[model samples]
Target: MDNLVIAATERSPAVDFDFAAGVLSLKGESYPEDASTVFGPIFAALEGFLGVAECRALRFDFELIYFNSSSAKALMNMFQLMDKAAARGVTIEVNWFFAREDETMKEFGEDFSEDLEHVTFNLATTQN
Candidate 1:
């Protein structure tokens, strides 16, 4: 299947989901007025991909400088989807990248990974 890519806008992030490569990434800021509008397609595509990806290493990178509460919710949903896939025997690795100076985002990444037991999760700070 073809990959999913969305350019970054003032209010949203850039999404790069390469299903064939098993590497997916989200970058930039996300505070879209309607979070669902931005994540709905992502959720669908990921769900479809997860259904067929078996025993494969899938790395998901989150490199967001900032995001709103709604975006946070969307992020959590993405994590849940990943966790489910991991539980189903998929090798899912998640790397959360936040600005070095942003303590809040760093903490958010930690808090978000607390519930994911089946996936390998890492948090790293990116130099601004």
Candidate 2:
């Protein structure tokens, strides 16, 4: 499938999905007025990709600075899907990046990682 790239906006993150490389990344703040409008297509493409992914491994990087509750929910759902894909024998790795000074974001990443199984989740920090 073709790559998916969405430029970042004031209220949304940038999405870069390299399907051929099996790598995806989302960066910036996420508090879109309509989370569905921003995430629906991504969810669809992700589901379709995961459904028939033949790649040996997939990597997803989430470098979000701030996100509202709806974005959190969307991310949890995405994580669930990734976990399910891992259960299906696809190797999945998730790198959740937070600023070193942002304890809240660090905790959020920890909370999200708690329920994951099969998918390898890592929490990385940035100097910013």
Candidate 3:
């Protein structure tokens, strides 16, 4: 599958999902006016990547300065999809990055970890 790489903007985060390397990364703020428009293609690409290979290891790194409720919902959906992939015996690892003082993001990571059985979720704090 082709890599999904999108530059970051003021209202949207950067998306660097490499299907070949099995590494997915999202960074920056995500409060776009149309959350669906920003995330729909990403979800589609992820589904396509996972559909082809069932045993590949997937590593996801998410670092968001700010995200609206709609974007949060989209992220939850992505986590669910990853969880399903993990259930199929795909090794998955999710690294959630947040500012050192941002407790909300840490809690958000914890909440998403509930649905994942084989996926290893790590909450990391950055100095930014």
Candidate 4:
């Protein structure tokens, strides 16, 4: 499958989804003008990829400097899907990278990690 790559904008993050390798990464800030529009295709592609994935190990890395509530909601939705895939026998790992100085981001990562039952979520600190 073709990889999905989206360049980051002033108000959005860069998305790199490699379907063949089962690796997906999102980096930079996200406060898009319209959060749903920005994340809609990403979710669609992820759903399509996961639908056909068979016991494959998937890794998702999220390195966000900041994001609004809307983006957070979209992220939660993505996490839910990932957990579902994991529950269905896919090996899933989520790495959430946050700046050392950003307590809010760290807390958000922790909160998000708590909701996953099957996916392995890790909170890693990045240098400032």
**Global fold similarity of model 3 (TM-score):** 0.95
Candidates' TM-scores?
0.97, 0.97, 0.95, 0.98
Of the pair 2 and 4, which is ahead by TM-score? 4
Angstrom error at residue 10, model 2: 0.5
Off by over 4 Å in 1: none
Which clashing pairs does model 1 show? none
- By summed lDDT, the worst window of 10 consecutive residues in model 1 runs over 42-51
* Residues 1-128, model 4: lDDT tens digits: 77999999999999999988889999999998899999999999999998988789999999999999999999999999989999999999999999998999999999999999999999999988
What is the per-residue lDDT of model 3 for residues 1-128, given as tens digits with 9 covering 90 to 100?
78999999999999999888899999999999999999999889988887776888989999988898999999988988888888898888999999998988888888888877877999899888
Predicted candidate 2 versus true structure: per-residue lDDT over 81-109, tens digit per residue = 99998988999999999999999999999
The candidate that achieves the highest lDDT relative to the unseen native structure? 4
Alpha-carbon runs more than 4 Å astray in model 3: none
* Candidate 4, poorest ten consecutive residues by summed lDDT: 46-55
Per-model C-alpha lDDT, please?
Answer: 0.92, 0.93, 0.89, 0.94
**In model 3, how large is the Cα lDDT of residue 122?**
94
lDDT of 3: 0.89
Model 2 has how many clashing residue pairs?
0
Q: What is the alpha-carbon lDDT of model 1 when measured against the actual structure?
A: 0.92
